[model samples]
Target: KKEKVDFIVLLTQSEPELNIEILEKYPEINAVLAEEKSEKYNFVTYVGEKPIVSPQGNMGSIVKIDIFKNKDGKIKQSLEFLPVDSSVPSDKEMLKLEEFYKEKLDRDLGTVIAKNNVKLDSGFGENHHARYEESNIGNLIADAYKNHFNTEIAFMNGGGIRANIESGDFRLRDAISILPFSNKVGAFKYSGKTIVEALEHGVSSVDKKAGRFLQVAGMEYSYNPKDEVGSRVSNVTVNNKPIELETIYTVALPLYIKNGGDGFQMLKNTVGTVEIDSEKNIDSDIFIDYVKKIKVLNPKLEGRIVVK
Candidate 1:
């Protein structure tokens, strides 16, 4: 008698390309349980007779799968995505832990550091205008970085500004929500030509909701979207004077960009020269301290990033 196996399921959290490669290498695989998500697929995606499913159950959601064997010895499965929202019952122990963490977080993040006079926006998905246009939130972050680090210019990525802040009391949590990353303030010494290249890189994808869009302080620039990418940026100025490509400028930005995150290989090349007094201030804390010092949040779009 031979041993019987109806299904071979694979568990992986790799990229979709690797997952597909694995399936191709092992055609015997019938299903893949993955943490990787793709908006293109809903519920389940099939590769021939094989099915790929993602159990993003970390969000308190539940996934139930039922398997059955027919008389002919073929295995069939059905999947259900169960919501764990208000209808679901909470575990008492988990609830206690949640309460403990929530209490700690509220106490730590509840301090009102500043008062906002207007709503500052980052963006709203594809409809987000901050990607190509100047935004107050972007201005706020950039200004904070530039002023705190005492740099000639600061270039904060518009996409890094995640949420909007409304008028009234601004708390530490508000700052964290806007800049929810572990990245610290980083400064670089770069030639004026590299600054131009950075600005060009920032505006190169003006047609898409690209994260490379730079939110700036201490400079104003204009670009023609219809023009070619490398030459789109024009009329670059720092301190109201035209940018001199030969001059060295001290620039403040997130460490992520300094490390070539978001395809900024140009800035990445200029990483070794640290021109700032300190590089240990986490971005969120920097934003908070900036707000505390300012005491009022009144960021405005001052024609910093212009599109012609």
Candidate 2:
């Protein structure tokens, strides 16, 4: 008697070379599922010696596989991938989903989070042009972090601010849309010298409108974009006092930055990092709370970052 074998499915987004090695190592593996590289909602399939890159259809996919024994007593396999559309749900399912959202997500909590005097600049789905300027939205977000954690300073990356806020009526969705990453708030102890280096790195790609541009609170500094990279930042101050190179200052920032996201290498290299549990200190939630407490938000371009 012979044993029956089952087909194997592998799901990954690794490099093509790595996928090829996996396919070579496992002959029984029939299909490899992954997100579409083309950024389209449609599903695409590539068959043959190379590893398969299956598209994750806009809503989802239903993959069906058939295995059977051939006349030669060898197993053969066939794959059927069905991409589901957003409207494929039954009427009953739609009703249930609507009810769930109404009970949980859609209800207005009757809370006014913050008031914006002017439309805050943001580049959520656009070119990310806010990374090159001292934006009112960025200032408000950094200030919220500083106030929430009561830290000496707070640093935020412009890339993290996903959407702009219009004047008046800031709701829960508005706040969530502006900071959708849900990164946890964290604190780190670093010397002023490292802080300056981090600032230099933040502005190094200003001409390219890179995401590494910084938005800060509880501290201010000046930089000349025309100056050479790594030497642009100067006149850093914390709490109305000039920063000392050897003095270690506590800083509040997102956990992503502490892990060196957006080229914040100095934050990652810091010896001790204290992360507030996400349940207790989600960035979006904290900022919402800060706004609710303050009632009115009037952040302005106060020369915190001077491009001389």
Candidate 3:
């Protein structure tokens, strides 16, 4: 007594008929089968197999990233597809992958900038404290120059502000953002030696990339890029009059520069210690008061750092 057996041969272009031995020789195919098995036994079987038809090997992947800003932040979602190679990717393929990564980094950086929620033309800290520090710090320097000293111009460094303020109620975190490093503020009296030496030190710092970009509350000067370093500054004026080096004028800057931190050695021994506040965090109070007074983007760049 014998029974009959039946076999079905499925044939179609939809699926490739692969010889088990030949397919095993292909490392890419073996990897694909391994991936399929691992997913099935994983803790969470969330996504199912959705193969991408490619010349090399089909692959599937999912990436999730979160982006936020201000008090309320938003999230963004995306999906990507890549072809798996048996070995290392070719040069052209690597270039394409690098470009994709660069775009991702740029997107993250933009997200960080937007979340700060401030209107300053250039700064690092959060919106509330950073803006307040901008207006207050500039005004503080100006007031010190006009009232404490007989100078009509005062300036600080923009890089002085380091961190950002947290929302609701601000604290040490906010102030740290405004003046993150241990740089102390100082007032110096110079006969226009302030701007000249500052520019010289600035040019010198071009090599080290550590110079504090100058932030001025009053006074103005134009530099000729075509001219030499020391002679680049021209038409320097305070209150509509030319600056006289022989006539001593008071200036405000961070102690980092006065102590020769950013390569300003000339100012190390020339500056005179004057009455001023120590390294303090007052941006939160200043910002809160500013918001209560007005709701607007008042800060604007007045050609402070121009490259033309």
Best by TM-score: 1
lDDT of 3 by residue, 104-207 (tens): 85554332221223422333422322222234344432333333333455555544544433333333334334444544455676667656677545543322
lDDT of 2 by residue, 17-101 (tens): 4566777777667667664433233343544632365554333566566677778876666666666766566599788988887
What does the lDDT read for residue 104 in candidate 1?
99
Angstrom error at residue 158, model 3:
3.8
Summed backbone clashes in each candidate are 0, 0, 3
Clashing pairs in 3: 69-115, 126-164, 163-177
The reply for model 2, stretches above 4 Å from the true place, is: 1-104, 109-111, 271-279
Each model's TM-score, in the order given? 0.75, 0.67, 0.44
User: Cα lDDT of all candidates, in order?
Assistant: 0.80, 0.75, 0.42
Point to the candidate with the largest lDDT: 1
The true-versus-predicted C-alpha distance at residue 196 of model 1, in Å, is 1.6
- Residue-level lDDT of model 1, residues 1-308, one tens digit each, is 14557777898755455677888888878778876242222346667767777754334455677888999987788777776578987899999999999999999999888899998787643346777889988888998888888888999987677777779999889998888876777777888898999889888876865678888999999999899989999999999999998888899898877777767888876734555565456898888888999998888879998888
Cα RMSD for candidates in order:
5.9, 6.7, 22.8
Give the backbone clash total of model 2. 0
User: If ranked by TM-score, best first, what sequence of candidates would result?
Assistant: 1, 2, 3
- List residue ranges in candidate 1 displaced over 4 A: 1-84, 87-89
